[model samples]
Target chain A: MAHSSETLNPFENLRLELRRGCLVLAVLAELRSEQYGYTLRKALAEHGMAIDEGTLYPLLRRLENQGLLVSEWREEDKRNKRFYRLSPDGKLILKQLLAEWQSMNASLNGIF
Target chain B: MELLDRYLQAVKFWLPKAQKQDIIAELSEDICSQIEEKETELGRKLNEAEVEAILKQLGRPLLVANRYLPQQYLIGPVLFPIYRFVLKIVGLCYLVPWVLVWIGLMTFGLSDRAQHPSGSLIGALASLWGPLWLAAFFAFGVVTIVFAILERSQAKSRFLEDWDPRKLPPVRDPNQISRASSIFELAANTVFCMWWVGIRSPIIVLGQSAARITLAPAWRYFFWGFLFLAFANIATSGVNLLRPHWTRARASVRLVTDVIGVALFCWLCKAGILVEISIPTVAPAKTLEIANAINLWMSRSFPIVFIVGVVIAALDVHRIVRVKTADTRPLRGVAAAGGLPQQ
Candidate 1:
């Protein structure tokens, strides 16, 4: 299937929000192993979902504020990097959100 | 150093004063770390161009900083519901009259004209143009008065539904008004002088014909009175801005300005300055051509000027309310907690 840029236009903004929504789950799921900002962005992109630094940076801060994620700054190679990991609270929330997503998808598909 | 400086400038534009320095420091550290990672991945030193490109791609610094700030609404958090309500009611009032006028005009041709006897049934139905116009004028007057009263009462109440006063800047010392009043006086004088030209033009042109009982010189006085009132307002606003303590006096000045503006405008029509232009051309017809022309001009211009003045006054009131509310919020919050200490 050939996908054109025009076809992608309507989805562009929606895609960003949907990706942000899923990033909560993705970050929690990924940070089961610790990762820094650039590494996480690259990892997500490699999995066919590209996230910008602008979006990733704020989401990380907000998740940390909500106590669903924890971060620590470490000096490596003479550069300080903040590494984020999934808190126990983040893991629980991610699991619940995933379950909710699946149920909603099932119900919507059934109705359609 | 250059890259760090650019990043700091971006953050400074968005963040508040207290948090800006700390946020900049953290952002710089994060960017440096990202650059190192990028350099390692590419197996080369990242050039200035590449680093700048990455930062630019990060989007505006304000956009990034705004994510941390709470959401803002047009009417602000406190007045949002009330604002929506007032907007809906005002919208309905305007829409109903407008729709009725449109329907009446449109159906006039379809209806019987001989029975109506005014060429159009709508004109006959709306024969009492006097009462309809008066009702409209009264409605506008009541709305303006209500808005002004509500604005002041909201400031005084310091209710939870009202805006947070803390967010507004502190009122400057009242001394600022004395210095500012001179400028306002100049502006008011200029406007008045222009209007005086408009007023005196017909008298100069029409001479004795302009002085007839129907040609009221009293109409010209309203314009003069408006100019004087505008000058008084300039003085009061200047004094209020400069001295900071003359709240009541400043408000009264504003109220007087509004009243004079409305009165001068209405009387200008009633006195027939608007009719002056058409009277010379249409006098042979002598069939109310002058009055019709005057009505046409007023209907076209009055609503526009009235709306513009109301909007400007509303904005001024909003600014004043914001300032006053900010000053009294903490006290009100404390008072609310203490269970009604004072009137």
Candidate 2:
């Protein structure tokens, strides 16, 4: 079974790689509503895209690093929490990525 | 606290020791804040298990940290400095030897023909040229060494930065092993062996010997050696072209070629066919005797070394072939048992 699956594994891996860049866009779009890590994960999962906590946390940090997301620490009921929201730059980039995605999808759909 | 501690431990292991504490502090702060926000949303106190579960779902800490780390280049950052340093060192090493050899040769040339006035004068002038050439040669060596060192250092640094030690690919793939081409390997090894036999052995040995004997045309041997090396490189390129997927076979063939090359070099050293000037002085004779002893040791020991290298290479090739064969076995078995044609 594993032997037969090898043929398609590379193709599947490539498809995953193609989707990796879009992950940043997806995170930013979700964060526009002001959410924490677990909520974001749950939101993505609800949309049929389950992201591992391992993948999400670091991605959030990276987006924060790139100045696409703004984060703040808030304390409620004696518990400290960090909340993230989309930055102006993030919103602008999300718009661009969405337009690009739509155009590419249309072009690919036409060919297929 | 337990969830945060686990994440910190993972971060410390992944980051360099110098930066570990700082990174861990930052990560812990972020995780703590996130947990607080979640507890507030649920309208209850968070239990340790709930926090641990959330952290577990976050996946591996190293994977998360990698996303935040700065991108590093493979070759560009370090190569330049290392190349410069190596070039400088190589130039110096070559220069000193070249100058001494040139002076010694010129002095010998002049003394040999001292009784012939015009010949002696010509010999003295010619001797100076040898030393000058030696200096030039040393400079060239230094330049090349510096470049090579720089390139090597840069390659090492880039490899360290880009290559995730934890995520190393498998050492061997079955498909690659099975398809290893023996013909291409043999052809490459043959060409490499030919160059070692025909070009390098003769020039280095004959050139040194001829120089010692005050031969006027000995310098040509060095040129010949260079030409031969170039030809060998061209032959290697041709082999690469012919066997585009010969990487699997390369290690085995190279091992065999190295063994043959070392053997031939030892033989040439023993035969004295390459030596030019033989002086029967006690001290020089003792030096020659020492050289002979070393050569003898190499000649005797090399066969074992060569065999070992060849054996290892063969094993690697065999492993690859076995995997490839095994991969196709089930299909073949099914086809045979079912009386269906194999695809």
Candidate 3:
């Protein structure tokens, strides 16, 4: 029997909630190295964290808006692509966030 | 390439006007790259179906566009808890009570006409569902409108931020004030008060007979007192429903009402001949005999009723003192920390 797309799974809902913040963090960290939307998604997927272009593109725009990332249009391989990379503000935020994440991870590990 | 262009256009249609061209350009580039990657994997160019599959994987155009749009909620998550809390209170205080009263009045009316066979209770309930549902929907609409207004004005954040945990209500004791039981008691007391005040004669006719036994002059003599007592009981229950905390003022009010009730019953007992049985077909002797039996039973029962009221009054007095003392120093700390204090 085919399951309806709208049929709810609590686990999936929870996974979405858990992923929401983690996705932001991952995007911020990955933008430290310059990449366009497609290449960034491929890079994340290669490292076992696949992000959809829809999510990645919006996130990049949002981060750029927040001054956490910068973007520019450049011709690459005869096709125009919008490239995104971490801004100075983004680099500072990333350092603080990594420390916070490390502390949280260490505390979690101790508890486990 | 044409399929990808159409897909990007669909997404662009939903994007914000300022960012339309920029978003579409980026999306078009990404799709072209994905198609290139797919062709490399398959060792051939793709068909329309393959491109459509990629678009499907990207998700619905509106949903994909929503990620780029600013997050919007009619009632934002921050205020949702308060909205839910208010809705719950409305349900418990308003909707639940409304539903209970509907069912209760139906049952009360049926009980009076027990001699006649009414249709199934389920059928009666089914018939009542339409009006009940309409009322519920109206309540939901009002709540939604109120929350939507709050959201629009951005007043929800102010409400959340300004809230003080110190002013939170104390935990209610299950024994002292059961909301369901209080509501039921309030309903019964309301019905009784209405019967006493509104009706000329409060009597249930026995069997299918036209004859009825009505309350005697004694009831008339203490009619105002009976009403005052009943109303006081109703009022006390109401205040408790609105504010369930057990405090000195509340306890004092209940104690005074209960004492008046006891006194009223005592007066009725002393002023014998409470209910006069009226049966035109019956003999004078039989009528006197029935009336005497009823009067005697009522007079005998009044003291017991008085005693029960006294016990309740005593309990109320005890509660009042305890709560009053708790309001003072040392234990005042407890009150500060969400203890049962006067509203």
Scored by TM-score, the top model is 3
- B-chain TM-score, candidate 3: 0.50
Interface RMSD of each: 2.3, 4.2, 0.7
**Chain A of candidate 1 compared with the true chain A, TM-score:** 0.81
lDDT (Cα, tens digit) per residue for candidate 2, span B1-343:
7666766787678776665764565456546656777888998878988888767765577766665566643334456456556566655555544444444334443333464445664556565666576667667666656556655775656554576677986444233323235455445656665665554333333443432332224334443544444455455445655543335345445444444544444344334342333444435666567656655554444434444444455665674465446546675454456544322
Residues B30-60 of candidate 3: C-alpha lDDT, one tens digit per residue: 9889889899999999998999999999888
Chain A (alone) TM-scores for all candidate structures: 0.81, 0.85, 0.87
Interface RMSD of 3: 0.7
DockQ of 2: 0.21
Q: Which stretches of model 1 miss by more than 4 angstroms?
A: A1-9, B16-26, B37-44, B74-343
DockQ of each: 0.28, 0.21, 0.69
**Candidate 2 wrongly placed segments (more than 4 Å):** A1-8, B1-63, B73-343
TM-score of each: 0.42, 0.39, 0.56
